[model samples]
Target chain A: MAERIALIDYGAGNLRSVHNALLAAGAGDVAVTDSADIVRAADRIVLPGVGAFGACMSGLSALPGMIAALDEAVCRKNRPFLGICVGMQLMVDSSEEHGSHKGLGWIDGTVRPLAPSDPQCKVPHMGWNDVIPRGAPPLLEQGEAYFLHGYAVESDDGADILATTDHGGPVAAAIGRETMIGVQFHPEKSQRYGLALLERFLKWRP
Target chain B: MTLRTRIIPCLDVRDGRVVKGINFVDLADAGDPVEQARVYDTAQADELCFLDITASHEGRETMIDIVERAAAVCFMPLTVGGGVGSPDDARKLLLAGADKVAVNSAAVARPELIRDMAQRFGSQCVVGSIDARAKNGGWEIFTHGGRRNTGIDAVAHAELLASLGAGELLVTSMDRDGTKDGYDLDLIRTIADRVTVPVVASGGVGSLDHLVAGVIEGHASAVLAASIFHFGTHSIAEARAKLAENGIPVRRN
Candidate 1:
């Protein structure tokens, strides 16, 4: 039987595009669901998010038992998980966007506003940038990916830094440990590089 | 390297179909916006913009459908503009699969609209579009496809939009729009230098050099051209090559 991949819907993120990308990447049983039961039962999980960190956090928290189910599925059951853009930022301990807001804290980090030393480095850090892999992180290959964000994660431990992209300096582009991974770039919008990453994530044993 | 300079192909969409007009007349059907978008995606264009040039309110729904269909197949970031007057209008397109919504005359009419949309959807999704024509000393904002002058300074307006929370600015040169002269570099620099957000240069792009100029000379973060890519004047790969030759970092796409 094909693995059931749950694409969590918390009233935030580009749900349709992500779903389509996963299918394009050859996932046969991808479910776009908001139900905790579905997430807990799924063999793999994908958490996608857009917009501000505070709003997305609130949207995800609005759903009862969703976070607890995510915790069980990802932390306890050890299912492979992936997060995109703000979804990746949500894995950090807290975010300074729109005041300090609590995140999933699944990874040891905090989301901070990107203040690139170069005045030329624009905010939102919009457009395609390089993804340089570090320490052979799973599901993260060296390539450029589409990025659209104003804030980025600052991991407490360098071991969790899966990939880094340069704006003014090194910004954490992808982070992970064990079965969980989070990417600052949008796989659905990253074209072939992004689809290839999704394919790797779907086939990844860890 | 920093973020690569983006090359975007603009599709003027009307009633669910892609169309290109000269001076907003003699409309010709280019093809299905979705199909065109797929081609651009395969061509490795960094991003795509769909401007809903539908003149009638009734045609707006069709634009939304087109956007949703395009988003399903194309993986690149999509920015949709035209007839985006309110936050709700932007919201519909965003929910319909647009990554960003560009506001033009509406943002000029009610600057708060930018703030409203940015507050709800985040600044990353709100794009402020300015169509400007060179005036007495500086450029002035023009509306209705550059038919009406708004008597607003282009540079000041760009600053206002950025401060209001527009994630990016799309500035078009009305004077050089169809002349194939090149982008209004001084105009782009004035605004690009004033704002911290990324700026997209639009209007006139005759050759690949214009694209590099938009980034290096105009100080624009992205260059948008319609006829050049749509009419087969240049392929996206050629444009990337040109920018690369000029020492401007561009996505391999």
Candidate 2:
């Protein structure tokens, strides 16, 4: 039987790129759709996002039945779900990018700007950086991934962090709970390691 | 984990085919944009640049087609430039799968365009491209594919672009472009020192040593080249190997 992968599209940015990347990562049954029924039916779910937190949250909530469908699929159904970049930020309790914007509250954290104590550290934190695994998550090896974001997840509990990266100081790179995982990097942009990670996500049973 | 230095391969496209020239003249066909982009991505190029040297209305449409096709197969970050007149133009390119849109002529004509792009797409997606030629005493910014000098001081304009919310700078030296001599380290160093954003050193890069100099001496966040990588004289793997040997950290392919 083929795996049905739902690449969620609630008009978030980088959807096309993520779709193309999912196909590249050997997902034979990848479908980019906005319908909750499609999302609820899929065996796996991938959410890709970019831009500011306020805008992204509005875009996601703009579709009437999206949040409920996603809640049922990810939280209730316990399906394997993955969030990228701003999508990962949505897993936090809130974001401070443009003000305090509420998030999905799936993880105990707030999305805050990467204000490295050192003045030399640049904003947006763009480019490829190493993702050091804090605890072993299936198929997620320690390697570099392309990261481009000004804000990151400030997890309330250290146990929620699956990985970390340094930009003047250590920042949350990936978070995990059961089969659900979120990464603050662009696997589509990170060549080999990214493809490998995606392949692992596809084959991940837990 | 450390942030790795990037190596970018730039492909100038005209009517959907890859073209090359020295200082933007006497163009020669290299290959298909899709082909070259796929090759570079598979080779693990940090990023690929697709510059539409011909900015005609029809050419813009063709560039979009090229981007869509290349993006379907290439997973790495792609930066598109060549006549982004407005935020809408940048938006179209970004929607078509470009990770970043570089503005040069339009940005030089109206500095507000840079701010507008940044405001719309966020500064992280806006790249300010400057082609500079050494003039009397210093370098002046050039536009229209490096055919015209704008008389604007390169460093001053770069600072303005940065202040206007440009996330990155792509500085090309006209004197050294296609010369196979080496990058203008002095020019790159000067502008890099003044800007807080990442600076990409473009033009000239004949040898591996030159790539090293771009990071070590010029202090560039990335090094972009055309002929060397296009002509197959040097590969991204080779450049990364050389950079690592020289004590610079680069992502392995």
Instruction: Please name the candidate that would achieve the greatest DockQ relative to the true structure.
Output: 1
Mind giving the per-residue lDDT tens digits that candidate 1 earns over A12-82?
88888898899999999998999999999999999999899999999999988999999998999899999
Output the lDDT of residue B126, model 2: 92
Q: Which ten residues in a row have the lowest lDDT in candidate 1 chain B?
A: B21-30
Task: Give candidate 2 misplaced runs (Cα > 4 Å).
Answer: A117-121, B21-30
**Model 2, range A1-206, lDDT digits (tens) per residue?**
88999988876578778888888889999888888889889899998887778888998898778889889999999999999998998987899887899999888899887888865466668788889888676557888889888788996567788899998899898987887899999998787788889999988888
- Report the CA-based lDDT of candidate 2 relative to the real structure: 0.86
**Backbone clash count for every predicted candidate, in the order shown:** 0, 0
lDDT of 1 at A203: 94
lDDT of each: 0.91, 0.86
Model 2 DockQ, alpha carbons vs. true complex: 0.65
Give the runs in model 1 whose Cα sits over 4 Å from its true position. Answer: B21-30
Candidate with best TM-score: 1
The CAPRI quality class of candidate 1 comes to high
